[model samples]
Target chain A: MSIDNPETMETPTGEALAEAPILTEVLPELPTVMDEQDLIIETRNLSKRYGRLQAISNLNLQVPRGAIYGFVGPNGAGKTSTMRILTTLMKPSGGEAYINGYSVVTAPREVRRSIGYMPDFFGVYEDMKVWEYLDFFAACYEIPEAQRPGLINDLLELVDLAHRRDDMVDKLSRGMKQRLCLARTLAHDPQVLILDEPASGLDPRARIEIRELLIELAKMGKTIFFSSHILADVNEICTHIGIIEAGQMVAQGPIKAMRQQLMPHRVLVITLLGRLDEAKEALLHVEGILGIVDLPPEDGKIRIKVEFTGEDLRMSEMLQALTSKGIPVVNFAEESSDLEAVFMKATKGIVS
Target chain B: METPATRTRISLNPLRPLLRNPVALKELRGRMRGPRAFVVLTCYLIVVGGFTTLLYIAGTAATYNTTGEVDGGTLGRVLFGSVVAIELFLVTFITPAFTAGSISGEHESQTYDLLRTTLLPERQLVFGKLFSALAYVFLLLLAAIPLQSIAFLFGGVDVEEIVISLLVLLATAIFLGNIGVYYSAMTHRTLRANIMTYVTILAVILVTTAGAVIALAIVEGLDPSTSSSGSEWVLLVARGIFVCLNPLTTLLSTQQYLVNQQTLFTFKYTFTDGTTTTLPSPWIAFTIFYLLLSVVVFFATTRHLKRIEG
Candidate 1:
């Protein structure tokens, strides 16, 4: 059955929360996918097309509980479309997504309850003061009037904007406005957060503050699906990364795993104390060493490429052979591939 | 000890929209806080009050030739006529401006999308705005009550008649507000909505008044006896029917209350076979029928907002 039309076709009958569906029994055989922890959001084959142009195509994403999953993509790569789909703001043309197992199409109200979405750009009613704006959204979220004051303060403190709680939103700096938006999104205490370009247009300090806030929220077990063009920021914080290009996931997995997957062969650059020419000749003669590049005469270092073929003794054997040749190794270490290198190699300059 | 259960809870708030929807309250506050609403209301009060004073002075004037006071019923009719005429003129100017920018203004300011994302249903948004605009109109009308009470100083104006007049005015304001909402929703620009709203009001007034005149003429031309019985009442009834379904006529209905003795027209009709027909109470029946039509219009506006895509 299509999700747009639920099986029973029961029109949303009332304003009260729907009754909880009874869970019969647990199936232990359903193995852990992604992480064994709770899946706050998951999508399979979600596609959104505008006319002939595919904005998002065949997208699959999983956001585990308490993880800050960064969706890194360039503009027009369908980051906003995916966020809109998950937030129940826009319907997908094909496929489906679930928020905490609630179907986005058939059960949008529930999905909305479970997620707080902050768009890239939005207007705040400038006529109202900070407290009134937060109070208004709290009401929209159906927060009880009695408990709202405390929740509002907590959120304000969380976003570090309690001092300007009385100031008009329009008077706030771009960073402060962004922080206020984040606080507003947290008013309902949603389990999952979808922030589109949260760090966009912010100065370095403000971006760092937003980054720290997301990390704190993650520590508190909130599932965060944040999209950004800032790869360095994502690398610093996000445990899982999804790189999108041309409305398709070019590469998506644990950052470490994806890096390992691409660069299985590690390169070692060694600067020697003595016997440099002999060391280069001996490294070339070593069986396990794939390639060797001698540094320029000014640099005085030899770089060797070593491919680990699931063998433990290969590196030791090469080192023993080099030592036997009387080549004293001064500094020898394998170069680690940063996220930027991994991302560049995997995407192959297709983002533009 | 409480047992842990694996389950999911879901519920929908249908009227989550209407109960605490802020649009109506916010719009009311916005309109009332504005300089335009204040200026319009103050002007209406001064005109209504000043006109009533002039009416009182005129009604007390002795005839130029006879040197005697006019009868109470004559004074009543004069006051009613003047009041209705004033209301008609004032409403024509005020109604369009109140509703012209309602929907279109939001679109222009780019606040429509912001409103939609707030989880408030579309119907609530439409009705909230419509009601808020009407509430301001209601306040404006309320401000005119003391001015209207000047008619009661003459002792001929009944309280019931005054109440009925105010009710009619209220109905007209609500009906006109809905017209503004409907057009605002349909059009994208404030300029277009304003032009269309004014054009719509003018078209309805011209068409209905012309139709009433033609219908009255046809009814009168068919019967020789009807000329003596009067055609004003029949024209009023036709106009009321038009106003009930037409927003302009709704505005005109408030004028009916401004008049002291509503002319009840009687028609002695002649069929093609040369038989005569008699009709009574056409004005009352038609006026009431039109009032009902105004309610239906409010419902129609609400329904239109429910399915609005953008």
Candidate 2:
């Protein structure tokens, strides 16, 4: 609940988290160390074929521990198929997937215990009360009856559904039901959450709430691997991203790294109240300045955009040089590249 | 926040975990909470009650008009047989409705993927749906026991008859329930599954009986003698095999044993090839056969589910 706690902010080491005594006791049948790999989710040449239609082909993905990985793809580009294979709900026609070191095909039970999966479209028992629904799933995970009450309470509070604990699940709004389903996923306190389109059909406010919840869960050291086509949502929250097109991984990396790779040059917009031409002339002399683009005046002030391929220090030095030139500099800021643009450029609009 | 008192309470409740099968518990809780279950139960009871009263009145009047006195033993047999027969019909009609939609319903509602991802195994999922549906059918059977017991108050119905009838009824429910669950797992559409389940049940009942009857008529024509000879044993064994396969024959044979203390297959067979055998009693044979068949169907369902979902 303490969002700003530094201890909670730090991502726990995979080994340390895997060796938690409570988890070991709850899942005694699973091996102590599934894999020594730093990646929490890994797939090697994972392919799925439905007759002649290949859903996924040679997908090699590595999601590090404690990463909010955004899986992006066009419709019917096999995002769901990949997630299904990873969750052990479906088998790949060829290759394999591993979660927390356990093979999805050979050690599905261990894989299931490590991840909580929420499908794109899921249904709840309408006649069950909210708390009872959670209790049923908790039992499915083999959480002890004695602990279920407390776990259910904490999950309800986390998803903001505590007030509707006694209400029938069907009576809740679509957004509330989605959150309740999220709470159900957290019943066993899984190390990773594989959510498929968690905010697919929600309104703007509901999508924001779901986005914030994912952030909170990441802060608590849970690896969140969710798929979404909503580029805006992924752009705002995802630390890591993987873009798939035509059953192939087109691009994947940290968000910051991806932005840099796709948009190599940074655009710096400088607004000057006076001597705009002098500021532009001075910026042109800076070493990293690739080009200077002219812009129309706003409020009797001129704006010039500089295409700079430089490090942070060089940009600061260029700003200092402009200030030292005695030119009236009103505002100088860099326009951050949008993720949507990067996604559009990376994918070829191919779908399988 | 572990309170010593609450922890002790949990540990002492040994049945807590055993009773908490997620699918069964959820199904039962949902079923009992809804008004539809209550409405169905009420309608079932009313229909049974009305039928029982009608059978009693009709039997009493027929006996009084035909004879100088009303024979309670005959009346008892008539009432018990009618009530058991009605119950068999009800169970056969209702078991498919409850089970055939279980798995397919999950898919239709878009919950099947979520369920498959859980720690619950395929066998547990299939059995959970099976047991939950059977539990409701068993409740319906239990509710009709009072009507069945009404015949016991008269002279002819004995404890053995009631037990045997109940066994046959239960075996029929198990068989039909398994069929329903099997089809549910195999088909994606609930309507198709339910239709196939009923078709399979009808085939088991009607086709086997018809086949046996036709085979018996042909064998009788070949011999053309009403003699109590070894050749007659062939006809008896054929009837026994088909009778064991048919639910109606199984229940009726149990009823006949209660009334006459005779096995369904009485004649012994000694073939010209020097083989000699006597068929087992219909109730016992059918119970074992039905249970074995159920196990086969249950596994088939689980295997199909795993192959498709995994």
Candidate 3:
């Protein structure tokens, strides 16, 4: 896939991610390297106040081009407000934001051209067929009449809604409507997609479908800035993640960098078939063991969480030492290297 | 329902932007498609046509005598008046309904945000909404022309009367149309917009009529023994403002003034003392006043939409 300006240059006009060839791109190509020139979305001390309530406060964000950036936080964390501000649907009370070098406040029209925004709620036009809905939005984005039909076909094909093109928009299932809404966003052939809770109310199957579609778009080199309270969705889909809490950004970078920064060591949870004191004494003096804490015992087995600052080889050696001391190591599972730790920190309001 | 008519290649004929504006095109398509538009047009024609036919039969039979003497001109004028009244009633009632929801309905459905985020300009959005919404009312008015022209066969209704009535009906639609758009922009809900549009219309009718009646009473209270140009001018100004605000008043008053005084667009009002004060005809006043009102309202709606985007 080609990476154009994705901002100042012309829109893709008609390109589907599924049909585009996937390049073997790795972490360096993804965002969180934090180069200023490649940043497609940026904010400087952006703040919004609704009457006396501060919906967003001092929000500084940086999202690079061609990155699927997940904005994760708990409910009422100002995700929607920030998305609304970036989409130019609402004005920011203070500070500034830019999309593709266009000021969100001053050059909103230009910003709008660069970004395709889908709000959390599914808002479809009543009495309109699915194709007509896409057609209407395509015309709205000022796509030429000559290219609208083919463009509509490409968009529907991309979102997997071609079969339901003739169905009434309101008559479709909720998941179908969401896919249609996502398809509508692509009608403009925008470079960046800013989705607010794209899979907020979808069933598990539908959520996975949306997640796969988003990953395909990312592979095709379109930057996606999506907000969700669900950490699991962000963890699975985002190449880069920004954790926000109470309208403030807690942490943002490539997911790997975030994991290393938050927990600069490997965490292993081991379950033992014994009483707690014997296993604890055996692993306490072992080399490469940073700390150990007893978790709730399961089925008369002792469970201990081990924080280790060591290599993969050392983890095996430490396990060997435990068994040599006549200690039973039934389960020695490595903890997932995901966003859960960072999200927990965000939720606890400790990142500030 | 799919209306593929709008799917055709857009033309470059500078006069046809409405066809290009997606909002207007979508609105026009949705309005005209399905059985709804046909049902409305059918119901309207049947009522007007049926009423005209029944009135003609009843009036002709009532005026018949042994010598077959009947004032067909009187019957014709009565038919014209009744037709105008019914059309006015139907139009005034339904014009606001079409536009009252045009903007706020988008808000209720949450599509307004999606629309504003598009590259489409705000003024174009307002224009598209207003133009398509009023298009149906205009279609209704034009369709009734045949029924209105039926009175010409009997005699007293002139081409001028028909033309003037049509103009007044159009101006009335524009007036109510703007009111609906104005309230639709100001309010967030269609029900509130509908109520406000009707309230504004009712208030204008009641206030103007009351103003006219009071001015007439003051003119009557003055001693006719004196040449009070002030009372005459007061009566004329109040009448002008009244006709300007109220379409029914403007139509009927202009017809009477034309028939009795033969004054067309503008003429002088002669004082009892050989002096004259020139004044515009009632329909002219109505046209100018409501059109200016519509322009003001158009700006108000535009400004509101701008603020919404900001």
Candidate 4:
């Protein structure tokens, strides 16, 4: 956890240095006040245009440090464009983007040093072995040659590709390749990771593995800002979610807060074994119940759907009230809110 | 658990990192790893060697009986000239093949974005590609040294001749390599870049030579007298400027200087008032012109890359 030594010169011959422990002294520590900062990646009125077509318009994003900010958008929704600007790979035509307090346009090298970018479609050097590929990138990042061997081994372990260290990159499976790419992004140990559709072409299992790996990276104090069209993957892993559509951000906030804001009412389903009439009468007496719809019985149990306007504690109290009155409540559950539903409510499917 | 072979392969070679160019190292390693590199190298040597042997046989046969003695110096000059000319031609084609795809290949493979996002600057990327391609071309030129050495034994070609020939060849490779890198940065498709690079090289070689020839013909017609005139001097100076930019002219000029101890185009020009002067050697002018032109093209390529990525 020491600062990078500017005086640590690399020998002209690219000789390897003495072996050291993998992670402890290798990577520079995260900035002390990074967590206290309001945003690790921020953009104000960011815009891009290709002649007449606007790729991204008025994009204002604030991604807090140490959070997995999922950028959710449909295809061609300017998600990739926004990520490109933030990664310093492209210029924003109208506005500005800052990474770790450095302007992407004004101080691009600093921005590059602060962020690891994984584009949506990237090519690996098929001729290179996994370890050699990592070593090459580490060299590009100016990591001391002596430090690369241990760093490569550590990254391979992190992405679960330790067994494929010497395997040709082209020989890896799609999932393994995706994981290897993720590992490559971590080679320089940047504080922020900007991944564009990291799981786009992955199978379900591969997607899950990438998701888990991203969660682990976030746990390691890295700010993960990734873009995806897959709402399920985003929902499962992202602590904060931003939904963009048609080159504009529709909504962005914490997942729970977003769900609550988009969906104000909850649907409660109650099942009764024998006291069907008793449960119906008792449910109508609850104060927060707006309406109740009786459903056809299945498996000899009565079902009722109640439109309830209450928080978790009030819902629990209502559940307790039913069981106290000899209603024989077999099951009482509230329907869970999902990202797909939230996305559907948030965007009008417009694209410019 | 390190094997001796692995240890040797991974050993720190100080010269390896001196350039501090990861792109060049990656490219050189990849270029040398495949059997194709060996195949190309072998073919190049065989062709150059086969051609030199044929020239020697022809020259020896032509002059063997007429004088009852073989003139080794004349025979050496013929062999040296032919071999150097062939190397120049081979390099013109070979350099573009190595460089035309350097940048565009990354784009084609979808790796350009990944590379651009790194801390590597655009200049390094451009120069890394140029150096790697030139390095391979230099290797090809190096392989022909033994064939050129045969000229020395024959006694007609001196070390200066061989050195000047290699310098011209190297300069030509560098100039052509810069063209390839330029087009590679301008275009995203490898095929397109390759075609454009070759076209530019052809245009340079053909147009410059043809233009100089036509201009010299007109200038020669202006004054048929053997005596040097002011107008003829002006034309000679103009022709020197034109021919120096062409690699063929530059190579021939260097040979003229080395073999005859004379400039490529020497014309005594008298001013209207009778003061006279001789034009500088085209070889010196060519060397300076090409080196400066290469720098300009390199900066252009670097600027194009920066603009495109932005």
Candidate 5:
């Protein structure tokens, strides 16, 4: 019932489209919006070079205040290096990064206080129990002794591990350990979270749980910078995605905007009940239809490439001619671009 | 509405949690929970207590024929002397076992980053561990005090001497403790740290002893009465440098106590021949040198720990 509860954040409204159009009618919050600045994280020509090897080169990123940005790249693509530089764990060899307008190098303590960074491969102190582990981190973050117990309890429950509060960290499953790690990162109540492969080695259920938790955090106006190899997860939850290849950002933008920019053309797949030679010959006379690539010899389906020049093109013209000849047009579908296709097209198939 | 009071409470230094306690209660508790610590402490007590009791009985029986009595200070000189020697022997073995595992053990367990990324500074880490090890040694020393106090039951035992001796032992243990910590910080594996620290300590002790022995021999062989005053002065200089080599300086800060009572520094030196010229007091110098060495080792370990990127 309450917005503060995570369940409320998860329940998406089907009537959201109708609700969104009403907000733009009055322009009620324009003056207030301009007062708040953008760019929680910004990098200016940030470069890291190990002798001749450049791990990350000229990385300039602007993560807005409340964006769940996915940083996707293959192994050794410098995602970890960039996270380290932003978190103040490692200094950039060339340029600098800012966290909430504070330079990471010059104001490291402020930057550290503002961001919670979780590296990909981290170990939990097995000797400590779950609560004790969180307690230690809370102490590390300099949380007041009186306030820590309540905060720790709240975080454990948030991660759905409150029942395992007294359990030894080593005994918990890998997923529980990861959730605890996230909870530990939030011990200081940091504004920004830079998670390097937060779901790197989780089971399917655990992966979904992490994804849900991240989406919940994003709704609470937190800036989450996460890197993952799972494109499906990125597609499902990320508001924006940046693809890095060989220390370079190949493509980055809102998913919808990127799809619109990259894919101006549409594909129409049609399956006819009766195959007639007249339907195949009529494909050339259509306007703005680039070319038709036929299905294999075994299948009687044909894929039509529709390039609409000025107005929306019609599949009805071909359907009308085919049906008028007593050939039924059984299946007509539009092929939409998903994140996988966008990633493939953007990277140009060169992962390294 | 109530009016607010105009009082402000300010904390002068807010980062005090990072200072954390140096006593290493966590380390002591862990060590106490294990059987190894108890066994070590037990063995140390038995050896030191048994040795003092045996010496007290022997010295009392041997002096029975004399009318003059053997007093507590004389008994303590013999008993505490052996206790210090055996402690040094145990320390050589035990200090390495505890400290050689510090950094390298963390590296082995892969929990190093857990501590390193925290607000705790590296010097605090080094000294925290060093003081913890020293506390264990101090506990063992306290256990021997009752046995040592047995000598006070007799006459002539000086409490100030006993106190000074314990202080010297604590300082020396701290110095050697840092040596093991420095080695542990330098290596990635505990086994290598253990081996290297043992070898290095052994080498330094042996080389210094050998050099001291040679200098003493040369001084003894020369006849100071027939030699020139310059040769006599050279002998004094050699003997003075020899004081630096003796680990016994660790026990007795004063120069006179470090040099053997039997060995003579030839008295035929200046115009005032036969008037003994005392060597300069080495307490201040040795304390400064060893403390400086400990500081350097702590700084080096901190530097090494700070450079760990991952």
Candidate 6:
């Protein structure tokens, strides 16, 4: 197969490995993009096409180490497909991908060692108890026999399924099963965790629990790359985010940067003890107040939603100006960056 | 994360993965934990054991010894053949049933990808599934030994004959079981994999037997006056190979040769020109062919899995 990077030239495959014999010579060093050595996962112009349908097209994604990178996209926008390629479960039709320093196509074994993948839909072996299930996977990774018991126990405790360690995997609830699967991905203690729609189909409590688990894992210094169509899940836990639409990344960077790029103005919700029109009238003269809309009053207090392009100092000055007019402001808070706005606006016309 | 030293295993021990395969271990645990394995084993033993008792009773009452004395050796041979035939039939079908779902079931349950991502390697996955599936069948084979040893009480079937029979039975189990694994690797649905495996094995048996029969009929119909050197001899060798291809025919023909004591390892064919040649006996030929075939199937399945993993 031909690759865009002429330096690597030929992709090392089974036949290539046989012909070359020496692995080091056959597998050329994959050039890191823009000298970002911290990128745990990188895909350059990676594309996959099934017949005439292109699942992914010229996709470039870079997830740095120890960053909770949220890959948000509409359905069928190549989230799972890209994750599969990175996990070495599928070959890209074109271009190349790397996990750490290992080329995914040429060095799949290394890539598999570096990353733990949890797919969108997964099932457990019904006959296996929770501990046995973990042990089985641990053995798959060729973990030493003596260490498996300790590792399984540690993993079970981490997922909070330690109390149910002896129960059959089939008996666990959907939420519990998801947690167990997340634990299964950790059987090898991989450097990167690629989870696809981890919180989908979970109840609110379970979703929150999963969110907390991810946060905890991130705090442990793992490079977590997860995909979600649920924007709230992305907005909650992701430090950096990539928004994909129509099989291409439209926006990607730190979550704050992407949010700012998607939304040019901040949303300020102000609650007043006095009249609403008076606050609106005072806000019309404030600097950086692009527009104002009166909101539904809560608890006998008038509320107004303000669209402002400003900093913290500008917001403070505006609040001071409103109270100076005897507007009696009860609350003035700027809305946090809502990834829903980024997801909706970025993936606007793509029909999944 | 695991320490850097233990992250990757660099060993030359080829059997290391197979020695302790998680797939096989997990499969054995799954198979034995349920009542399904026990139920199947019970049914298999009943069929083989039940057949032996019925055959023993019938052989006892038969009038082969017209002098009113029982022919113990003849009765023993009859019982041995009866029991083995039933065991072979059950093993042929039962072996594949255990293996046919091995890989495909993983796909159906959505665990195939999870299993593949690990460092388990493809060959281990294939053989692990094969061993775990055939382990129970092998157990059934071993369990039937007592019923087969009934021949020893009557003093006809020797240990050599018993060994050859078990060898053929083991070969048959492995061949059919590997075929199931082959189809399992090729397909996503277990039911379809099973159907394909059964069809392929049935075709092997029917085509070989029918081909041998039809070739014999055509050769017999040819003019007796004509003298064709090497033609008839080649046909004899061809017929022997064909018979050996079918496990049932191989068992019967090998047993027949052992009873005749004409040859142990080979059959000598005399041509019209008074030249003679020897061909390997049915059991030897059958065992060697199936052993090589099983190896090929194992490698083919591994290669297919590697491709699919991509």
TM-scores of all candidate predictions against the true structure: 0.75, 0.86, 0.89, 0.87, 0.78, 0.87
Error of 4 at B165 (Å): 0.5
Candidate 4 local lDDT, A282-316, one digit each (tens)? 77777788888988998988888888887788677
Q: What share of the true interface contacts does candidate 3 keep?
A: 0.58
Query: Please, what are the lDDT tens digits per residue for candidate 6 over residues A314-350?
Result: 7988888887888787788987656766667777767
Residue-level lDDT tens digits of model 1 in B207-261: 8777756765665565454443345446545644554444334433433433423
lDDT string for model 3 (B264-307, tens) is 78666666555877678888878877788889889888888887
Query: Could you tell which candidate, 2 or 3, scores higher by DockQ?
Result: 3
Worst 10 residues of 6 chain A by lDDT: A25-34
| CA deviation > 4 Å runs, candidate 6 | A1-37, A269-285, A291-306, A326-333, B1-19, B218-224, B270-276, B308-310
lDDT of each model, Cα atoms only? 0.68, 0.81, 0.81, 0.81, 0.69, 0.83
* True interface contacts reproduced, per candidate: 0.10, 0.66, 0.58, 0.56, 0.14, 0.70
On TM-score, the leading prediction is 3
* Regions of model 3 farther than 4 Å from truth: A1-37, A274-286, A324-327, A349-352, B1-17, B57-68, B220-222
lDDT of 1 by residue, A323-351 (tens): 89778886766656677777778775655
Clashing pairs in 6: none
lDDT of 6 at A299: 92
| lDDT tens digits, residue span B185-234, model 6 | 99988999999999998899999999778766766665545857657766
Residues A1-352, candidate 2, lDDT per residue (tens digit)? Answer: 2222212223255453344333222211211222324799999999999889988999988888888899999888889999999988888899879999999999988998999999998998878889888888888888877788888889999999889988999899888988988888888889999999999887544665687788888888888999988776677678789999888898997888999999899888888888867887787777988888878989988888888897887689778889999888888888767787788789977762
Q: Write the per-residue lDDT of candidate 2 for residues B266-292, one digit (tens) a residue.
A: 423444344666655688888889989
Models sorted by lDDT, best on top: 6, 2, 4, 3, 5, 1
- CAPRI tier of model 4: acceptable
**Cα error of candidate 2 at position B148, Å:** 1.6
Best by lDDT: 6
Q: Give the distance in Å from residue B95's predicted Cα in candidate 4 to where it truly belongs.
A: 0.4
Residue A297 miss distance in model 4 (angstroms): 8.5
B1-310, model 4: which lDDT tens digit per residue?
6532355467687756545687887777778876988999999999999999899899987756466898888888889888988898899999999999999999999999888888888888998899888988999999898898898888967776677677778888888899899998888888999999998888888888987898678675664545467566667667777788887787676666556654344534445445777656665677668778889999999988887344
Considering only N, C-alpha and C atoms within 3 Å, which residue pairs clash in candidate 4?
A: A12-B18, A13-B13, A13-B14, A17-A146, B73-B156
